[model samples]
Target: MFRVFKTCHLFKQNKIFTRRMAAVNLKSLSEDKIYEFLNSFDTVLTDCDGVLWMDMTPIENSPEVMNKFHDHGRQTFYITNNSTKTREEFLAKCSKLNFHATKNNILCTSYLAACYLQDLGFKKKVYVVGSEGVSKELEQVGIDHCGVGPDTIKPGVPYKTFERDPDVGAVIVGFDEHFSYPKLLKAASYLSDENVHFVGTNTDERFPMDGNIVVPGTGSLVRCVETCAERKAVIVGKPDTYISKAIIKRFNINPKRTLMIGDRCNTDILLGTRCGFQTLLVLSGVTSLTEVNTWKQSNSQDELDLLPDYYVDKLGDLLPYLEKFKPTNASATMLKFFSKSLRVSMAHMLANKENYERFATQRSNNSLLAVTYSLSYIRIDSKLCNQSHVTSANPSIIVPIRPDITEYEFLFTGNHTMAASNLKSLSEEELKRFVNSFDVVLSDCDGVLWVENEPIPGSPEVVRRLKLIGKKFFYVTNNNTKTRAEFLEKCEKLQYQAKLEEMMCTSYLVAAYLKEKKFNKKVYIVGKEAIGKELNAVGIEYIGLGPDPLVGDSLGMIENFNPDPDVGAVVVGFDDQISYPKIAKAATYVQNPDVHFIGTNCDNQRPSPNSNIFPGSGCMLRVIEAAANRKAVLLGKPEPYISQTIISKYGLNPERTLMIGDKGDTDILLGKRCGFKTLLVLSGVTSLKDLEKWKRSEDKEERDLVPDYYTDKLSDLLPMLSNS
Candidate 1:
């Protein structure tokens, strides 16, 4: 039960409460981590105003982020609750700010108000207690509206003598510069007939203020009408059903394939929860981490609805990942590491200061450089500070060199810093040593082995060689859309040998996760029959598997909806049969407060055989997230849970394990976090340019995305394996 505190002191007391649930902070993660999160959504529904701008000034890099989504073939829409602006006005602002948008991609409160009235088939006039934006939008839909001009309250005016229009079948409330007592009286008089509808553009309690001064929101006036007429108004904006239905129907959006990015949890995150879109909260706007923590402790379901699936410090931080780059000339590079120490003999070093200074000056002038470490102490002239070589008694002292020295570079390569990449190709001797170090191999299926459904060159030979040599390998995939049996069948078709136990997929991991947790309750499934089958195999019953075909008189299902008490969890994956009823049921079941939420994987796009894009499981998972207002335990790549299971089940040693994958964010990031050596194969997704960006980044989080090693393709390892 949700408790409304009458006193401010009780509300303050609520802040200190503790809860286990928390949003995953995407800001601190590597570039690969952010990429995995972004790839899980097909459509992006973003809130404007605070998220993209502070009133007028654009938030840094927001425009580029939206454009990047478009470049990646993800759909985007700007949804706002500011009813004062018409569609055209919003478009003008978007254009000025360089936000990549179109008329079809913008969804505002005024436009939603017009859509709601049209859906209602209300031919009669609407008495609007708002601005010209609402009236203009209503006009576009061929619906007549009035009450736009000033209706200011006069001191001597007789309130009882106010006239009403009989043709006014509805009262629409929005932001109004001319709102007065007379307009309220007129609107209430018309709404007295319970048949006359009352529509509110938004229910925001207050507008974001500049300082101490707070402006009243449209919700204030909507309350006045409701208080007078004793009837609840239909809200058309965020956290409401009207806009969600409109956007879904207009765009034919798949709920399972959409994302909602916003700053405010109450409106933006709440809307996402209602629509089943994955929500990303940014701290660049209205919400703070402290407010989210307070919500985490709340028992109220409404408070829970405000939680986002993931959050970033700001949207602009994604710029470094998306920025374009061109690789430098690779011919000039040289391999550097040799036996953990330089081969230069310290006995040959000159102890004389003048001799050392002259030698250092000549070497510094030349671009050619070599780094040597010695325990012996030697002093050089202070004037020769630009010298390439510096001898110190301190073994830890590192000699600094020119920035343009690309022939050989010694980057701080470790678990704490970004993984260093070899600028040059690997030698035959080096490849053999690298391949011999790992005892177990964990490989990603889609990109590493095949692109679009066909096996890459030399990939099959490499896998066969590993198997022939008795190397233990696991085909780990975030492809929860298909079952392990299906995956094994695909492997057979591709001529790649695999055992059922050797395949680790998100679906199987999800089932294993539930079984390990000892959860015996039935599950509400928002996915295909394959997921249901997996659950059944683990003795977990499930409902809402296939499409719940829409019926003409289906309002009864919603009105009389009753969730099963035995249903203790909601698991979401790719569901071709997804429908309104399935979403309703899953959302309802999850609302029980005790029902756990689980997602197979957060993969948004699948690589098609023809190179076309298809929605992945993340879409469906998002839909349940929006409706249930809860986060899911993701059992897939980049999420530590799946890796933990694989580690425990196979008894694999992280120190001697190599994780090979095409995508760096999911496959490589997963390997890095699991304490395994990661090798990035440029057979798909991440490019050499992408790797260079992470390597050059100052942000430690972005630097963490760099892989321990990289190769042109997985096939490059075949020659060394064959010789072995």
Candidate 2:
């Protein structure tokens, strides 16, 4: 809520460190609570046209704030969200405005969308539907333009007639007031076609125009066309995907390091929150002092869905106050707690003001040095895939592309037994024959099946096509935690078919091995309760792992097998709550070689949305492996019995089957050792870099760990199957 007092509280409260604590238990507070909150945000996003100056004239303290950012090396940017101007034009304007913004720092609406479209392999006639300024912006991006000539729309007609092309793959909708009904109808007809993509420049119902409040903006025009076509277009303007991505790329700043600044709470802050950037709101522009709903009961609070990390009358005035700000030791946790209490996203102080002012700080409007999408959700083709797992190491060996690879030169390497990579170079019949030869189809889980819970591009379609063509396939994975049913349910959610009889998992074989041992004594489990549940179904007694009462009297399991010297094996699985005490006990128990020690699987880690990687079952295995200088038996994928468990369960002819996955160490090696064919697709973990590194390795196992075949993705498989 704004206070509209004409900056009357322009004076700082003396004894600011004595500000009342929301939490009373704290002994010392931040140096300056106001400065502390402001420090939470590291970057600022200011609009060029209005806030900087009403179209051009410098507003008060504009240069002061610019100089502050320059002096402190703080991340500051002038985001116009203006589609009318290109990057060069925006930089030129910044130069004219005396901010000295560069082409790399400033972001325009149309340019980002253009770059994304090119990246996405969209080749189509860009039908322009905006003013001459917007048309010029499109021309700067190398777009093959074909659309209505530059003119104002007729008084009654909201659009102009441009001859529609059936081959037009995309229609870029922008602001056009001098419109006609005929143009509107034609655009609607083309946009409604399923193949043609519809992209809007912006959704602002009105923008600052020649000193007048005009209703003629992209939002209103887009609504008219969308209403006519009964569809919504992908908005690519300010506070949208384009500008957010632009800020990411221009700043080279990770989402964690960037912040979005604006005056309007709904449009400005919400974009930052949703785009994974921190947000700051100044009580300067759209939302004024008292109009905000405070009770939290109204629809507007939920509807607007925006809140700033810090609230202030103006953004520029923040610098002068932060010099005296203090901080507490536990301020980090307090910050998250305070944000949750106030229903805001998390943020914290970035750097000291003097540090920013001394060593860095440039005055150009382009404070952002690097930019890109925080989350680049690319929908790639399926094939050579596995469960969604992240890599622990970053690439250090840089492979510079040179004359080694060129179009129509190389194909059918040692791994390309099916000659599928040569499809591009082959004739229609040759491609058909090659596809027909692929009787076996293998699939991975992560990028090909689903990145976590979401399925990859055409996953369902690829599976359906494989099924139709009577291609025998298998879902192979290295993650050995959950049993067969869990993996099947995941597949079902991704709209893929799975038979319980056809299921395979690493945990199943481990459970069977434990049952075979027939140890009559209590088995101390380190993994999930599900493993215990499986063990208990076979009349085995197992105590809980956590701080539950059941584990209270289970100390003797750590000592030598006392009860008739037949204590069962110590089974370790992926336990989310295994404590250090339990590990210390297990380490002591496994000292006797007579007592069998078993672990579920040896996966290094698992992926989660959390900041740190969850140490998987492999961490537990490593602890035991170090204690007993002998390798424990592995019963997971890439292992024989892991695949055999599914075969025994389904009673499938194992010799005729194939294993499909991306990782060479797990998928290809396992399939080759088991007398099964392996198929690799480039949709998941293993990339061209991995292939090059592995293929060039001197190790014998590494040299032999090649897939029988490889393809760019699984979607390519379906087209080949159809042609065959």
Model 2's TM-score against the true structure: 0.40
Best by TM-score: 1
TM-score of each: 0.48, 0.40
Against the unseen true structure, what C-alpha lDDT does each candidate score?
A: 0.70, 0.54
How do the residues 489-528 of candidate 2 rate in per-residue lDDT, one tens digit apiece?
8888888897654455555555677777765777776777
Clashes per prediction? 11, 35
Q: Which ten residues in a row have the lowest lDDT in candidate 1?
A: 1-10
In model 2, the number of clashes is 35
- lDDT per residue as tens, model 1, 1-724: 1111111111112222121234678777766556555555668888887788877788999999888888877788999988988889999999999987888889999999998888878899999988888999999999998898766544576445565677889989887645444565577667767888899998764455343223445665565456545477989988776787788788888765677888888888877765556678998866789999888877775576688878888888777776652222222221111112122232243233444444444432212223222111222233233343444332323333334333223223123336555513777777778878898999998878987568888888888889888788898988776788988888888889889998888778778888988998888887766677778788988877764654542244454566678889888876655554565576666656677888887765455343222445665565456444567888888888877887888888889998898666678888888999898887776778888777766446667678889888888777678778
C-alpha RMSD of each candidate structure in angstroms: 25.6, 24.3
Q: Which segments of model 2 are wrong by more than 4 Å?
A: 1-31, 148-163, 208-215, 294-301, 322-724
